[model samples]
Target: MFFAVALLLPAMAAADPLVGVWKTEPDRKNLISHIKITACGDKFCGKILSAYDATGKEVQTPNIGKKLFWDVSSEGSGKYGGGEFWVPLIDVDAVPQMTLQGDTLKVKGCEHVLCAHQTWSRLQS
Candidate 1:
């Protein structure tokens, strides 16, 4: 039983997808930031490391250290569910489904029920 438990621990730890920095593509200059994700009392959360605007100027948004991800639980298969993201874009709050594929994370939402997507790529450690 002891040996079996040890083997299982590593497998479980490897499943978390939000463990590194992520950069937005096509226009990486606008939003280049790091998301350090960790477990917070049965829930997972992420924080912004550093963010810059389109002109490479650092943004001093109020949510710099805020919890960008929360109430999210890993659903296996490199996917996370039951979470919402608050970005600087939309005025009204929106909740979208999030997925992780290797180092790539994708978020999907609807604008007037029309499909919209945001892509993030993991930053190299």
Candidate 2:
């Protein structure tokens, strides 16, 4: 029926290879989050989808709909850069460079002279 089809449309939607949900590696506090990346005009932007504490339990936070990164420009050879990532835990905006390889995404960010990196996996349907 039309109602059922409409309800299923979102679930059936195919995710773009570069634009989908990603699960971030655990932070220093062992907190993990799900981020959804989407195309914003000619660039890519990401927002926090959900958060999980160290105990693998969902936790509500003020950053639920906050931007994780923005203005991400893609380079050839599966590399992405030229964006700023808002590090929620440390409350800093760092320049982000990302590389996409298969279902794994490698993300590195720098704020001033300090840098950090994390490997994220694509969220499976």
Q: Give the winner by TM-score.
A: 2
Cα lDDT computed for each candidate against the true fold? 0.63, 0.86
Worst 10 residues of 2 by lDDT: 7-16
lDDT of 1: 0.63
TM-score to native of every candidate shown: 0.65, 0.83
lDDT of 2 at 91: 97
| Segments in model 2 whose C-alpha atoms lie over 4 Å from true places | 1-16
Number of colliding residue pairs in each model = 0, 0
Which residues of candidate 1, in runs, are more than 4 Å off?
A: 1-15, 25-29, 55-57, 109-116
For candidate 1, which ten residues in a row score worst on lDDT?
25-34
Candidate 2 displacement at residue 94 in angstroms: 0.8
